[model samples]
Target: MVDARGLSCPMPVLMTQKAMKSKEDYYEVLVDNKTPCENVTRFAESQGYKVAVEEKNGEYLLKISK
Candidate 1:
């Protein structure tokens, strides 16, 4: 799991992409802002990956599974 909260813009997606490069099953990302979440989801979707977005309190949870 990658906790990307407080990160801005493409960083979350970029970091997640890097983290998932070595992953073969599932990954989870946590972002405080919606834009980063959206960007991450977009990046994941572009790669033909499945992502689930959920809100817990004020934070966003993005889970990508292969």
Candidate 2:
């Protein structure tokens, strides 16, 4: 899991990017705000990942997979 909670836009996306370099089949990205969630979603999808977002208590969980 990429615990990006409390992080801002590019940091979250950048962290996710670094994780994705491992070439895994799945990733769980956690962010506390919508902007990071949305940015991560966009970046992941652009890389051919399927992103599914779940929200609870204002936190966003981005489930990214091939």
Candidate 3:
């Protein structure tokens, strides 16, 4: 899991990108706000990942999978 909950834009996406280097079948990204969730979803989808979102305690969890 990529814990990007307190992070801002680009950083979350960038970190997720770095994690993607491992080429796993699934990814979990945690962001505390909506923007990062949307941004990450966009970037992941652009990279051919299917993004599913879940929210809890004001935090967004992005599940990215191939």
- Could you say which candidate leads in lDDT? 2
Candidate 1 lDDT tens digits, 1-66: 889999998899899889878956788999999899999999988877899999988899998886
In the predicted model 1, the residue pairs found to clash are none
What are the candidates' C-alpha RMSDs?
A: 1.0, 0.4, 0.6
- For model 3, the superposed segments whose C-alpha errors exceed 4 Å read none
- The deviation in Å at residue 36 for candidate 2 is 0.4
Backbone clashes for every candidate come to 0, 0, 0
TM-score of 1: 0.91
Q: How are the candidates ranked when ordered by TM-score, highest leading?
A: 2, 3, 1
Query: How good is model 3 by TM-score?
Result: 0.96
Which segments of candidate 1 are over 4 A away from where they belong?
none
Q: Could you tell which candidate, 1 or 3, scores higher by TM-score? A: 3
Better of 2 and 3 by TM-score: 2
Model 3, position 56: C-alpha lDDT score: 94
Name the lDDT value of residue 36 in candidate 1.
95
Q: How does candidate 2 fare on TM-score?
A: 0.98
Best by TM-score: 2
TM-scores of the candidates are: 0.91, 0.98, 0.96
Per-residue CA lDDT of candidate 2, range 1-66, in tens?
A: 999999998999999999999999999999999999999999999999999999999999999999
